[model samples]
Target: MTTWRDVQAAAPEFARRVQSLFDAHKHKTIATLRADGSPRISGIETAFTDGELTFGSMPNARKGSDLHRDPRFALHTATVDPVEGNEAEWPGEAKIAGRAVHSGSIPDGPDGDLFRADITEVVLTHLDDSATLLVIEWWTPTNGLRAVERE
Candidate 1:
């Protein structure tokens, strides 16, 4: 179970970890729902703006189409071992629970598509080289990501 208080406390740390992996990891997997209740997944290079997340893709992609129909989305951002570096492979994952809605009229470049998700739940799990694995989970009132006051 996760509480708003915990989320408030951990959000800064979470943001830092995420930023570390953003360009280095370069790949994020997003899972969305199909109309028939099946799962659709895709790899995306995510962009975060004003606390909202967005990505670029073809209009026909399953994720884009699914968002049109279902609007719900889940994002998993993970890190892999670097080829050679002083940086340790701190495997971390964040679960983003939010609704996907079309943001722009024109589909071009980074401005192509926009998804404003009211991330309500963020569960960050990481394997620490110096310490044991750590897991932090946070939840919102609606149970999943929706509109909620930021900490």
Candidate 2:
């Protein structure tokens, strides 16, 4: 399992950009697997602190149950549509796919359950400076960062 710190060490600039996009919004989304192996998408918020990525769920929340039953998850940063004539000002959206590890028990706390990400991949997608081609970049624990531009 790779930590967010490991991703940072592997690709600092990419990590910084990814984190910025996450920080730009207060809410994001997460995809978890259901008992039937279908996907359940839910609204979520993330924290990048203490050199780790973390999120929480209300007690007995479906998402929490999903993680416990199946740790695999894909988290996405909230996105804002690019201004029609100001595409260059739109920061790319970011995504992270990995397993969710129980950070710890709340133990009489009101925050419900907390989990840390064991990242496998992080991706950023945006338009090029000329706002023509789309640029997609991804970083993995083993592969580092790679990019491709598409028209």
Candidate 3:
């Protein structure tokens, strides 16, 4: 499984941008599939440590149960609304999609469930320097980093 460190080694610039977004805030969003295959979004905090992205859930939390049943997940960085006239300064957003592999248990923390991410895709979206185009950079295990710009 590819770790966040692997991504950093492979695509440092892209990884830096993505990490900056995650570092800009503490609260992020994680999406998991429900029993009926519907989408469920949960507010979560993430940690980048020991070459892995980790998060936990309270005991018997629905999100924890969902991950136990299905590891697939997509995590998004927190975002701030752009100023009315200064939209160009917006820092942009980042997302990571992958599976959560059960790592172990959380110690002294409500006996919560812990999981580490196995990254499959990472993406960053932001305004270009001129702020006239939207720049999207994405990275995957096989394809590596790729970028696109749109008006």
Candidate with top lDDT is 2
Clashing pairs in 3: none
Instruction: Sort the predicted structures by lDDT, highest score first.
Output: 2, 3, 1
Q: For model 1, where is the 10-residue window of minimal lDDT? A: 142-151
Ranking by TM-score: 3, 2, 1
Q: Which stretches of candidate 2 lie over 4 Å from their true place?
A: 106-109
Q: Show where candidate 1 strays beyond 4 Å.
A: 1-10, 79-91, 106-112, 139-151
Q: What is the C-alpha local distance difference test score of candidate 2?
A: 0.92
Clashing pairs in 2: none
Candidate 2 lDDT, tens digit per residue, 8-65?
8888988999999999989999999999999999999888887899888888999999
TM-score of each: 0.68, 0.95, 0.96
Question: How well does candidate 3 match the true structure, expressed as C-alpha RMSD?
Answer: 1.1
Error of 3 at 126 (Å): 0.1
Error of 2 at 149 (Å): 0.5
How high is the lDDT of residue 102 in model 1? 70
Pick out the ten consecutive residues of candidate 2 with the lowest summed lDDT: 103-112
